[model samples]
Target chain A: MSDKHMSSQFDADLNLVSSKVLEMGGLVEAQITRAMHALNDFDIEIADQVIAAEETLNTMEITIDEECSNIIARRQPAARDLRLLLAISKTITNLERAGDEADKIAKRVKRLAEDGSSRTVNIAEIKLSGEMAATILRRALDAFARLDTVAAAQIVRDDKAIDEEFRAFVRKLVTYMMEDPRTISAGLEYLFIAKAIERIGDHAKNIAEFIIYIVKGTDVRHKSRDALEREALS
Target chain B: MSDKHMSSQFDADLNLVSSKVLEMGGLVEAQITRAMHALNDFDIEIADQVIAAEETLNTMEITIDEECSNIIARRQPAARDLRLLLAISKTITNLERAGDEADKIAKRVKRLAEDGSSRTVNIAEIKLSGEMAATILRRALDAFARLDTVAAAQIVRDDKAIDEEFRAFVRKLVTYMMEDPRTISAGLEYLFIAKAIERIGDHAKNIAEFIIYIVKGTDVRHKSRDALEREALS
Candidate 1:
């Protein structure tokens, strides 16, 4: 084959892999939504569906990772192409873990259903945070597909809102548990659910950070928000 | 350069990266230990040290990751060498996050110290679990250094013990909070700390899983314990 032909072929391969990542991201987003629905309505079937989907998500991660390795070996991609492959590898890991967080929420909802306790503690904050996490995750995936560092930086900043909401929710749960001892067990379960949602938001933020790194060749992880924004925008 | 000389140079590069990984692992292990001691004794000085060390850990992760990418770009490593580089990239991520968990423990300890609430609930179980987590993390790093799948599989199994300890401790804490509302605030703090330690164990298990993958060319993550053991031994 001509050199031009080989280069285009490599580009095609990269495109294919990028598409698979988006497909996986979409499925993960769906899992979070279904898990949250199960939690809000105490719906067992939806929870079970989310639980069963975990295996599929895990398999997708391994498959995509192997594909990345194969491409690197065959093409010997360098520079920006190499960095994009590396970022994809890391992005899929975050997506897989986000799926796991959804699975965790589903399992907790199932347990809460089994206990047959009336939902005394209000979980409105948790439900709202779950939606926020799912929304941020969707936006992050969009930013990744478009390679939009501006949007990615915005997602990074948006993650802090979810954290604040989580802290406020935890405080409210503590107050409820203290005022009424009977609500302690249920409140703890809600706390874990809220934590799962917060982690989902974090995973989304991680994907956004990878976008900045892929585009700017500057890693924004573990940096202050201001520094990350400057790097992503610069 | 001759082919043989080039191959030896590549080997030296891999060795250097591997040793750096171990050095980072050692520092992360110390972070966990110091954070736990700070938690146990409510010592602000040690807690401050753990928090301060986080910047160093973050920098090490980025530097090591960059080194991995550079090796891939320069060496165009194939098959096992490529796999090792990819695994190193992922392993450093887990190590860095484990360091984050330690920082979390330290920050929580600082908060608890400021609150000045008498330790009403016995956290002996949490303390024991923290030790177990640290020991397993050390073992996992050793397994990685030696490429010992047998030891890696054992670390995977041992992680279950820490999870059980966490569950038992949470159950006990729930009862305590129900009995005495005054302990509710401090109990929640301990709960978060216990959760952080559990996450450390999870990260260690992830590193062990990567080691198994590097050696056996199989992905053991999200697999059943029996399946993982059989693959590791086989």
Candidate 2:
């Protein structure tokens, strides 16, 4: 009940929360990579495993979130500390979404197997999308762990590249569909997979923003309002 | 400084931020609806018109985002205010993306005009996609402005529907491509546009989360993280 005791306990609790978030972040990264591998290899073994792994990732998200919430409520953290906790909470959504998108990738792999098509695209296309996603997941987590706002800002940019690559592949897949109606169904499934991968990149970017939210303790919303006001002023 | 001066200033600033977000939100909705109209009518005129309007939407995005950042820095909002500001910032990203997706719809129409093609799937698919996007955007923005957790939660389900609809279209588009390899290029382009629209849905879902962040003051990351963890645990 002493003030000194209370302060130390609070400090320990904060450390525990950070460690928990980092732990979950690692799991999310692994899941994203596994899902990407499943996509590239169309390895059902991996696909099934990734699909199954999502449950663990989901559970971690919940536990970590609850822990953070309980701390905020109990400790009533303010200013920088509060921002850090809030960031942890928001980042988990991004992590879990990345996981869900991975599930979609796994689902596509399972479907691709079911379709029984041997034909493959450049694989480069799929690989490019997958790599972009993997990069974002990795960078976002690193920036988050470090509380590196600079790095996180850079990470969101990577999404633009992934997007460009995904868009190009979609165009190619559609062309393939036009070239041979027979390949349309098979190609379309892969296209869906690619779309999911692109989404992983987006979720990663959202995760990166949390770093900015935490370190700067600034809301990014002003970026939007400024633009709107300018229009009205004009 | 007098308390009266401080309180009045806060009111003035809050009004400025909120109004700007609402302004941008309205344009986002209109642009998306117009793009849908272009597709439904296969009306090149409307499509061309949509293309013309894109600059407006894009400009708004940049301006609104900047305003949000400025406001956040000045106000230093916490908890609900912080969430609202952050949500406003993020909402613009979604709106801009939705605009980008809509712009694609316009571009596709232009392509149709240039290529001199007729209806491949009629207007039903386009109409359906457009309507879904419009609905999601409206609901997402509304949830944000009102900070209505229940409404925001509903947007997530709506997003799932959008995903389902998009998947159906991909299948149909694939069928068309298989029937004619020559049509693959154009068919794929259309499908790519559809994917962008689906992405817009995802962004709206994200904005809905922002609403939850504002209302519950609990980071929703765990909402997703727990799901993954449960999957992992199970």
Candidate 3:
């Protein structure tokens, strides 16, 4: 192949891999949404569906990762192209783990459905946090697709809000459990569900960080919020 | 440089990267050990030490990841060498997260110490699980260094034991909290500590699976135990 032809082919290959990542992100977002719905309504069917979809997400992760390795071996991409491939490799792992968190939520919903003890312990905050996590995750995927560091920096800042919400929910759950031992069993379940949502937010933040890394060639993970924002925005 | 000289230089680079991984692994293992000791003894000093060490681990992860990228861009290593570098990159991420988990344990220990409540809720099982997690993590790193698929498979199998121990501990905690509401707050802390240990074991299992992938050229993650063992041993 001519040099120009090979360069275009490499670009095409990169685009293909990028699209696959977006497709996987879409499926994972659906899983999170369905899992939250299952929790809210105790819908065993939706929970089962979410559980079943996890295998597909796992397969997608493995496939995308393999594609990245193949591209690295064949193209020997350097500089920005190489960084993009490495970032994608890491990004998909975060997505798969986020999907695992969604599965955890679905499994807990199934357990709650089986128990059939619908008690009102006020899970409003947990549900809100779940929504926020999902929204942030969607935004992260969008930023990744566009390589938008500005949006990614915003995500790094937004993760703290989810963490705050989780702490608030945990405190409330503890009070509920202390007030009524009957709620302790179910309260613990809620705690885990809230934790899963928080983890989803974390995975989203991780994806956002990877975007900044890809765009700027800077590792922003493990950096303070201020440092990360400056690196991503500057 | 001659081709042989270039190959030897590449080998040295690979060895340097591997040793850095092992060095990082050693620090993480120590962090886990100290975090557990702090939890068991309510030693705030030890907890502080663990928390302080986390920044070093974070830096190590970023440094090692950058080295992998540099090697990829410069050497364009193919096949096994490429896989080894990628695996090392992924493995350091897991090790760093495991270090984060240990930091979490330390922070919780600090909180418990501040609360000054030495309640006698049976945490022997949690302690045992912590020890198991650390041991498995150590062995997993060893397996990675040697590319020992047999040991890696065994670590994957052993992760189940940690999960069972976590379940047993949670069950016991729930009973304690139900029987006496006074232990609810402390019980929840112990629950989180146990969870951190379980997650550590999970990170170890992931590292082991990577070792299998590197040695066997097969993706064993998200596979059934039977399938993983067959691939690893065959």
Question: Which of the numbered candidates is closest to the native, going by highest DockQ?
Answer: 3
Candidate 2, DockQ score (0 to 1): 0.23
Q: How well is each residue in A143-186 modelled by candidate 3, as lDDT tens digits? A: 99899999999998999999999999999988999999999888
Candidate 2 stretches greater than 4 Å from native? A1-21, A55-91, A118-122, A147-168, A171-179, A202-234, B1-16, B41-93, B139-161, B202-234
C-alpha DockQ for predicted model 1? 0.88
Candidate 3 structure quality by residue, lDDT tens digits, B1-234: 012325788989988999999999999999999999998889999999999999999999999999999999999988778888889889999999999999999999999889986555889999999999999999998998888999999999999999999999988889999999999998999899999999999999999999988878888999999999999999
Worst 10 residues of 2 chain B by lDDT: B225-234
**Could you give the CAPRI-style class of model 3?**
high
TM-score for each model: 0.97, 0.72, 0.97
DockQ of 3: 0.90
TM-score, prediction 1 = 0.97
- Which parts of model 1 are misplaced by more than 4 Å? A1-6, B1-6
Candidate 1 on B1-234: residue-level lDDT in tens?
Answer: 012335788888999999999999999999999999998899999999999999999999999999999999999988667878899999999999999999999999999999998378899999999999999999999998898899999999999999999999999999999999999999999999999999999999999999888888888988999999999999
Chain A TM per candidate, in order of listing: 0.97, 0.88, 0.97
